[model samples]
Target chain A: MKKIALGLLQVAGLTVFSLLVNTLTSLLHIPLPGSIIGMILLFLLLESGVIRLNWVEVGASWLLAELLLFFIPSAIGVMKYSKLLEADGLQVLAVVLVGTFAVMAGSGVLTGAIYRIKERRSS
Target chain B: MITGLLFLGLTIAVYLLAKRIYASSGKMYTSPLIITPLLIIAFLLMTGSSYESYNAGGKWLSDLLQPATIAFAIPLHKNFKVLKKHAAEIAAGVLSGTVIAVISSMLLAKWLHLSGDLATSLVPRSVTTPIAMSISQSIGGVPSITAVFVILTGVLGTMMGPSVLRLFRIDNEIARGVSLGTAAHGTGTSKAFELSSLTGTISSIAMILTALFSIGLAPALIAVFLH
Candidate 1:
C-alpha cells in the first residue's frame, strides 16, 4: 500500500512539473514543446544529482512503458483522414518503408566503419 | 459523457488484451500498437460512431503523453555513462541517419506529388510518436496522420531491421542498436533489448539523439526546401 501511494505521488509530481513547464513555455514563446523542455530540465536535474533517480524512476518508467497505449487515440484519429489515406496511402507507405531501410543500412554501415577506424587508430 | 467513458473503457480493454497477445507471442506483427488501433477502428466503424466521440475519451489517454514525454529523461539519464563513452560514433551514425531520414522522406513525398501537409507530416515519420506528432503540428502537418506514419515506420523498421543490418554487415552491437533506434525509435529500441541489454541501452540513447536532431532539422529542412 505504501509503495503504491509513493508511486502515485511520484506520478502526480511529474504531472505537476510538466504543467508548470508547459505554462512557462507558452509564456516564453518557446518554439519547442513543453515536454521537450521538461525532459531536458529533468535530465539536467538528474545529472546534477538534484533529482534522485528513485524519486521519479518508478513513475517515469511506468509512463514510458505505457507510452504505446497513450498513442492509441491519435492513431485512431487517422480515421478522420480516410480520404487522404485512400488516395495516397500506398505512396506514403512506400516512402516510409524505403526511407526506413535506407537509414538502417546507411547509419549501420557508417557507424560500424567509423568505430572500426577509430579502434584501428587508437591501437 | 457516459458514452465517452464507455469508449475509453473499450479502448483500454482492447489495448490490454492486445498487449497480452504481443507479450505471449513475442512477434512484431502481433504488437499491441498495431493491433489495438486496428481493432478499435473496426469497432468504431461497425458501431457507426464518429472519430470525435471516440476521441472524447481517447483524448484523456493521449493527454498523458505530455507527462510521458517528460518521463523520457529517466532512461536517458540512466544510461549517461554508456552514452558518453561512445558519443562519437553514436553522433556520427545518428547525424547521418537523421539527415537521410528527413531527406529521403521529403524527396519521395515531393516526387510523388503529395500535398504539402502530407509531405510535412512524413518528414518526421522516423521519430517517436509524441515527438513526431508535435513536430508534425509545428510544421503545419496533421498530427494524427503523422502518428500513423510514425507507427508504420516503426513497424517496418522492426520487421526489416535485422535483415537490413545483416546485408550491410553491421556486426557491432553499437552499430546495430544505432541503426535500429535511428530508424524505428521506441519500437527499434525494444527490438534491440531483445538482442542484449547493452545493445538496448545504445539504441535508446541513439533514439533520443535522433529525436533531438530531427526536432530541429525536420522543420528547418522543410522550410528550406518546401517554402
Candidate 2:
C-alpha cells in the first residue's frame, strides 16, 4: 500500500512538473522544445535536491522501460501514407539506408577522432 | 469496442516479442525500437487494417512519450560533471554532424535528381521522429516517410554503433554515448545505456544536442537548398 501510494505520488509529481514546464514554455514563447524544457526543469529540481533520486526513479524507470510503446501511434501513421510510400518506396528506402549509414559513420568517426585529440591534450 | 481490445492486445504482444528478441540476441539489433515497428508492420500486413485504425488505440500508448522524454533528465543529471568537462567538443561534434547530415543528404538527393518530395523526406533523417515529422511537415515533406527514415536511422545506429566504435578503436564512454545519440537518437541512447551507465548518460545529452541542433539548422538548410 505504501509503495503503491508513493508510486502514484511520483507519477503525479512528474506529470505536474511536465505540465508546468510545458505551460511556461508556451506562455513565455520559449523557443526550446517543451519536453526539453521539462527535462531541464526536472534536472534542476533533482540537482537542487528538492526531489531525491529515489523519488523519481520508480516513475522514470516505468516511463523508460516502455519508451517505444509510445511511438506506436506515429509509427502506425505509416498506414495513412501507404499510397505515398508505395509510389516512392524504393527511393525512400535507398535514402534511409544510405543516409543513415552516412550519419552514423560520419558522426562516429568525427566524435571518436576529436575525443582522442582531447584526451591527448588533457593528458 | 472489440476492435479496440484487439488492437491493445496486439500492441502488448508486439512489445513482448520485441523484449524477448532483445533478451535473446544480446545485441542492439533486436531492440524494441526496431522490433516494435517491424511487428506493427507485420500486424498491419496480416490484418489489412489502415494505420489510422491502429492509431485509434495506439494513441493511448503515444501519450506516454511526454513522461518518457522527461525521464531523460535523470540520466542527464547524473552525468552533469562529464557533460561539463567535454561540453565544448561534444557541442561542436553534434552541431557539425547534424549540419552535415541535412546538407549532404539534400545535396546527394539533388545530384541524383530525386523528386522534391523525396528530397524533403530525407531532410530530417537524422533527428528523432517527432521533431523529424514536424520538420517534414513544415518543409512539405511526407511526415510518415520521415518517421520511417528516423526509425531506420536509429535502428541502424544502434546495431552498427558498437562495431564501428570497435573498428575505430574509440572506447571512451563519452564519445560512444554522443556518437550513438547524435546518429540514432533515443533508440541508440537506450543501447548506450546497456553498455555502461556513463555511456547511456552521455548518449542522452547527445540526443538532446542533436535534436536541438537539427531543429535549428534543418529549416535554414532546407530553405536554402530545397527551396
Residues A1-123 of candidate 2 have per-residue lDDT tens digits of: 887777667767777777777889889998666787888888998899998899888778777666667766565566566786687766666666666566656666777777778889989
- Could you give candidate 2's per-residue lDDT for residues B1-227 as a string of tens digits? 56766787888788888888888987666777666777777878798876667767777677667777899888888879988988876787777778878987788777667788878888887787777887788878988777877776766677777777787666777777777788788877777887898888887888888888887788898888865
Each model's number of backbone clashes? 0, 0
Residue B210 miss distance in model 1 (angstroms): 2.8
The most accurate candidate by TM-score is: 2
Q: What 10-residue stretch in candidate 2 chain A is worst by lDDT?
A: A71-80
For candidate 2, chain B by itself scores a TM value of 0.88
True-structure lDDT of candidate 1 = 0.86
Question: Which candidate has the highest lDDT of all?
Answer: 1
